[model samples]
Target: MGDSIGFNVFSFFFLFFLTDIAGVSPAIAGTISLIAVLWDAITDPIIGFISDNLRSKYGRRRPMMIVSSVPYAVCTFLSKEIRNLFYPRNCLRI
Candidate 1:
């Protein structure tokens, strides 16, 4: 749910923000967005397959959820941190 919302927000605002505010070229911004979208589309089905077939004691959903949370949180954090690191002047204090 949250991820879908984030993706929607990213698709809507992030290209403008990247090009206008962060000084990224439109081509680069588009590439970044395309890569993210493509990566999600590819990995989701693969992860779904792995999850459905897993025989863990904690069951498929719980184990996959736990395993995936680390990357989710890290990516969320790094998104902000990378912006701040490179474009501190443009970064808001959120």
Candidate 2:
């Protein structure tokens, strides 16, 4: 099982911080998260399938993992940009 307490605390704290402390609207947060979830749902399986089918001297998963590192990091860094676009700058902290 997962760490339920940690997950719950994180979820509560994050939503509270976003909606109350940070002044973000609930609808904006939900919309951005929904889009991110959908994007992950579509991309993750494709990435896993490609990785699993790959045949290389360096190894299948390892190669994909290595290649994906930069893009993943970049995406994480740029996620705020997409999120910021969904909400007014005065209403949220980027």
Candidate 3:
């Protein structure tokens, strides 16, 4: 449920934000989104393969999930910060 909501929010807002505020054309924004979707589709199976093959004391997937959380959070934070800093005109005020 959470994942679904997050994906929906990201997809809807990302396109609008890119085209409306960031001055990207709709076609280009759509192409970029399509590329992202394709990249995600390609990576899912690769990550699943890795997770299935991984051997660790903590288990196959849990350790990877735990270890990846910090970097994921950091990346999310940095992306938002960079956008706010470098694209203040397009940044959402909160």
Candidate 4:
């Protein structure tokens, strides 16, 4: 679905930006990303399972969706942009 595509695309660009543009070593970037992907793999299924079984009055997934939507979008944008704009080396050399 559309949401899945957004998540996939954002994750791909996040990894690419980290390794390629953010000046992180490729090995570290890959390892970090691999760990994140594995964590996502584990968490997504559990979240989906819970959402599928919920019987809340406000709707099973709506609350989570609402709570996560803004933060997810904001963090994705910041993740892509913030790293390039300010790095530890730049900060420390000031």
For each candidate in turn, the TM-score is 0.73, 0.56, 0.82, 0.66
Q: How far off is model 2, as Cα RMSD?
A: 5.9
Higher-TM-score candidate of 1 and 3: 3
Q: How would you encode candidate 1's per-residue C-alpha lDDT over 19-86 as one tens digit per residue?
A: 88777998999999899889999999998898899998898799878988999999888875776677
Better lDDT candidate (1, 3): 3
Tens-digit lDDT track of model 3 for 1-94: 9768866877779888789867899999999999999999999999999999999998999988998999989977875676667765655663
Task: Estimate, for each residue in 14-48, the C-alpha lDDT of model 4 and write its tens digit.
Answer: 66766666678889988988998899899999999
Cα error of candidate 2 at position 27, Å: 0.8
lDDT of each: 0.83, 0.74, 0.85, 0.78
Q: Write the per-residue lDDT of candidate 2 for residues 1-94, one digit (tens) a residue.
A: 3748755665556666667865789998777668867998999899888888999999878887788899977875664465566766776553
- Model 4, runs deviating above 4 Å: 1-9, 83-94
TM-score of 4: 0.66
Residue 26 Cα positional deviation in candidate 2, in Å, after optimal superposition:
0.4
For every model shown, the clashing-pair count is 0, 0, 0, 0
Q: Cα RMSD for candidate 3?
A: 2.5
